[model samples]
Target: MTTTLKISPIIGNSQARRAAAASFFGSMLEFYEFFIYATAASLVFGHIMFPEESDVGALLSLATFGVAYIARPLGALIFGHIGDTIGRRATLIISLIMMGTATVLIGFLPTYHQIGIAAPIVLVVLRILQGISAAGESAGSASLTIEQAPEGRRGLFGSSVTSGVAVGFVLASLVFLPIMALPEEDLLAWGWRIPFWLSSIILIVAYFIRRRIEEPEVFAESRRTGHTSKMPIVAVVRDWWRDLLRVTGACLFLAVQALMTVFALGYVPATTTITSSDMLWVWIIANAVSAVLMPVAGMLSDRYGRKPIFITGCISLAVSVFVFFNAVGTGSLLLVGLAGVLTMGVCYSFANGVYPAFFPEMFNVRVRYSGYAISLQLGLIVTGFTPTAAQSLVGVGVGPAWFLPATLGAALALVAAATAWTAKETAHLPLHELGTDRNLRLGKRRIS
Candidate 1:
């Protein structure tokens, strides 16, 4: 007797919800590891990992933070292939392991005083590895979650992953609050390492949860039907280049993020009386608001449209960043916190919430992972150095030239909004029908 093994034609809602939860916690844990490095770059690395000249050290530390972006594209190409060809689950697991291991090693690294010139070199190398890991993280998580989502709900599920990113920022800030309170000597010597070390615990738990997640039926069905691409990167570039460019331009909005978190943290404390602890509080509050609202933004995209919400976010962010910097100059923590909330929390959330679904929806499942990952990382490469560039423009120890970076951010935001306007609206398209020709949708030709 011959036996046939049957695959489920449709994924259950329960499995879909489970995939969404896994994406949420996976992003939360992975980014917790990533952003802690950002916090340390702003507050601790200059003192411990570089020469004692405060200005030069601060610039170098922020430069090291930027180094990761250079490697991110490389990671995106490598892992995007794996995700498209092998499966999203395996790609996610591999990236998490790389990220977690690098973060923990950073905690144990020797200071410049102990290791001389080798310290900063090693620091930059590790930062690059972290960047590589991050390259795969959101792309894989979002791809998995959206593939599992039922029709008309992809935005809502994808937002859960983005909202987890906001939660990661909150967790990173909360963990560092006590560390930021330590005396300068203690903070530089040891307190900062604690946050990096904490990532190990989160990594282990995340690994186990992610390991059990089944591959999304959409991807699995693609493979069974012989629709999987052998060279996804080449296919994506050739077929989806227009969408690729649009995603890259839309991703320029991340410059707003670089300025909001890394640059603002360093700027507020140095140019004003706001303590590092106060800035930490600002991070906590703003990201908390963002975490709550991101899902709402996603759901709104599911109903109204992706372009409207994202374009509005770009415009609002352009305006609110200026308000945030001015509030910092006023030396009022309350105003600064409010501005931070408006900029990072409310305005940014609108674009961020829907991007996971929006970007991937621009391509067919055969190349969706590669298409989104490559374009997203290419855009990040420019924004990643934003803090270093802002520092150069403002000059260390000069009275707040906050306006320069803020102006740069506004220009980038407006450009991203314009780019977002050019993309086709994909929220209402069926998952199987995404990335098909517009003529097919218009019934000019039959859809395959």
Candidate 2:
């Protein structure tokens, strides 16, 4: 007698493609909402939000920039639990709504001059909301994409979310570049609000698309098997603490990226003669290159493995920081743009492309959201302070313009690289085996 084995429903070629496209577009919109604030915080908020602090406005502005990251891990824990317990689709939809609402509110906020201290207070509150929502977005989208991807192509497919982030930065810069280019008198008054207001349209679109996406197959399977954790945080901390530590360490690479992109923009504007328009141009050029390069890096990680690509990216960033800072300090627009393009476009893409696959691959589906979210956000929280810390290190013009921060960035990247080296290689492992102790042992055996 012949017996037929029942097969689970597979996400087909058409569906996978559709899902990836939706994920990519939705992530792009979501990040656009998130990053436009970063851009504005660096360029415009010093004047509008904290106009009183003549000596420390830039530091305060960047501090507010870091404030959002303070809320991120909490957001991650809350949203990650909901995502792992309920569904990735539901979590993502709610995050998009929260981020969009906060961004739109930022556009409408009164200036410090108009409302005194109340303006910055309200801005910080809204920024915290945006941070909370962003903490779950990449993790949720990555979880959805990886679960839907076909075997042997998870690395390639999973990277669409990161690709979306690069696209979002590009879109944010493109939107802000034009506004910054407007006459100086107009820029501070109404032009700065345009990018924040435009976030609404993308938010609405992301909400609709996310609402339509089906729950990931793996998540559904976990629920069916009664394998879902009652408390993902406890499970992750107990069973996957090592992986969480490693991922948290690996995330220092992201600190360098954010520091260069967001903090550096504000830093250069204050210390050097570079105009805000010129700085915006640098962001536009670099992110435009990154938009193309990130996917290529993602594809390459599929072929070469995640570690080599990530390591190369980190080393490149370490070296590039010196040149990037020196170029900015010299006030050469061309060199500044080149530095931005090379660091963000080339070096950062290597890390960005691989992380979506790398971070999720470190955890089991049951605790994947919690492990990835908590660790990554915790690491980011450290880097979020980097802008302020780096500024403090360069105090009162006694230190060299780029030396202190560049050294700090380099040191952080090296530590992350070392942690990554200690991490188990998951490129060849099956999705079901990921995040289990057995896989780590298996990886060690194979290496031996």
Candidate 3:
């Protein structure tokens, strides 16, 4: 019989708290920058930078948002390597600086009227940089925080990181809500740039907060013992592709948010007479509620299992997505708000809350960052192009063209559920036994 042993990790309870806090701040700050870009892309970029054909410019500007996803894998490769060989702390700090500096620079950028064709080109470049920085933020923080937590509590801590993302969505929307209320000309001319500029204050704040956080002991232990992989991604591809594929498939649930936030935010405003302020508040309030629900959902994952909660969330989200878009189409503010909260805030929270624990636990600590980052970002590339596709299909028909976002979102959530069904139950596994458990030792019985 396998006997339980009293555990000792290099991280103590205090450091665990610090890791959780750092993870939360990193996720919050990184996604805050991202949502700001998303808002600017749909609301302002088409108007200011791509002024040729406002409609086509809007589509093209939205595509630039997708362009960032392409750079994410590159960042995953680079930072995942650093996270595996160097340390999570350094990799995260560097990524935050890169993402933050790029965002601030975008704020100072000249509009197309002032800069000609150079305007959209520069914005795309900054956006790619932001994407690269973002590639590692969530994965690195998840792996780091989960590794630092005690055996039974990994889900809660990891979920804290994702909860920060909910907070980021809320904070980003809140920052843009008043700006959305401005008159058209003022919004296009100068008001659109204010939110981007305000990120500077937070970046300065995030840097200090992240600076105090130390490297996780699991990564440190691996480094000290020379157990780290020379090329983490290669190792992952060679030995762990099954888990990688599963991670990618399960990550399709992210489509719910992509469609709901990016596609809906752009689609609803254009299709019907829904006010921009109303749509913004829908997500703002939903995400604010999600920030509270996310951690609680994570705790449920700890007691139950990741797959059940995740699958339930996926199915719930599928139904919710269809209803959310239908609500938006009807021009009912109450239904739209209710639908956004139910899907984005609650259902999506259940699925998203589990992944922080679920993803990292699928791999060993050695390649955890690489496996999680590459898989997660690679999956995101599909969802990233959704807004562009939705824009292109904007008034095409009553079938696939019109209902693309909602329909595709529901379908992808089902795909995620199917994949999640195949993962081994991991809730009861000790942190050390997580990925390496099914090896030669599994068949040999030991009496302790």
Candidate 4:
């Protein structure tokens, strides 16, 4: 007797929720590892990893942050192909493993004092590996959660992943707050390493959870129907390049997040009177509020469409960033803190919250992973260098105060907003209808 294989139903509400939970926790752990490096780079690296001259140390430390971005695109291309051709679940597992290992090794590295010139060189190498891992995390998580989501709720689930990132940032800040309070000697010698070591634990748990999570039904069906792309990257480069450019441009809004955490935090202590703790508190508070509101933004996008919410986010970010810097220039702790909350928490939330839905929806399933991963990571290269560039620019004074970080943030924000405004609204399109002109929804079934 011949037997037919039974296909699974299109992801039901239960599986969609499970995927969102997986995406959330996976993102939380991955970003927890990432932000520790970012936090330490801003607060501790200059002292331990580089030469003792404070200015030189600060510049080199921030430059190391940029180094990771340089590696992200390579990761994106590799994993994007794997996700599109093999499966999102496998791609996600490997990426997490790489990130976790690099982060833990960073915890054990010898300081420059112990290792001479080779310390920073090792540090740079590890940072590049972390970048490669990160390149896949956001895109894979977003695509998985998106494919699993039922119609009309992709934005809501997408926001869960962003909220995971926000929570990770908050957790990273809380872990470091006490460490930063340690005496300079103790902090350099031991306390800072503690946060990185925590990654080993989070990584193991995340890997297991992600490995067990099944590939989304939609992608599985696509493969069964022979609709999977043989060379997704080639297809992306050839057919979807315009959407790729738009996605990359839209992803530039991420620069604001980096500016908020890195440049703005560094700038306050390096030039202004605000304490690092005070700034950390501002970050903690603002990011907390932003996390709470991210789902609201996503649901709104689901209802009103992605472009409107995203464009509004970009414009609000533009105005808020200008105000944030201007407030910093005034030297009042309250004004500075409030400005941070307004820009990072409120204005930028719109930009960050909407992309998980807006970005992935732009491509067909075969190229969706490649399109989202490559475009977003390529845009983030600019964000990675933002701290170094902002610092360098301020050294020469630019047009009152707004001409520095604000000008850069505003210009990027405006460009991203224009990109979103011109793009087609995808929220109303059915999952099967999305990213298709001639391409039809490959595999679909009636859920019984």
Which 10 consecutive residues of model 2 have the lowest summed lDDT? 1-10
Better of 2 and 3 by lDDT: 3
- Candidate no. 4 TM-score: 0.94
TM-score of each: 0.94, 0.92, 0.94, 0.94
- The lDDT for every candidate, in the order shown, is 0.87, 0.80, 0.84, 0.86
Judge candidate 3 at residue 221 and give its lDDT.
79
Candidate 3 Cα lDDT to native? 0.84
User: Which runs of model 2 end up more than 4 angstroms from their true locations?
Assistant: 1-10, 51-54, 271-273, 395-399, 438-448
* Residues 1-448, model 2: lDDT tens digits: 1222222333354556666776787789766875787777777788888866487887788888889889999999999899888878888888878888888989999999999999999999998998898888767888788877776677777778877877787788888888877887788888999998998888877777777678777778888988887788987876678899999999998888667777787788788888766777777677778777777777787778888888888888888888888887788878988988888888877887788888888898888887898998999998788878887777545557678888889888888888888887777788788876743655532210
TM-score of 3: 0.94
Two-way TM-score contest, 1 vs 2, winner? 1
- Candidate 3 per-residue lDDT, tens place, 155-195, comes to 88889898888888888889898888898998888888888
Worst 10 residues of 4 by lDDT: 439-448
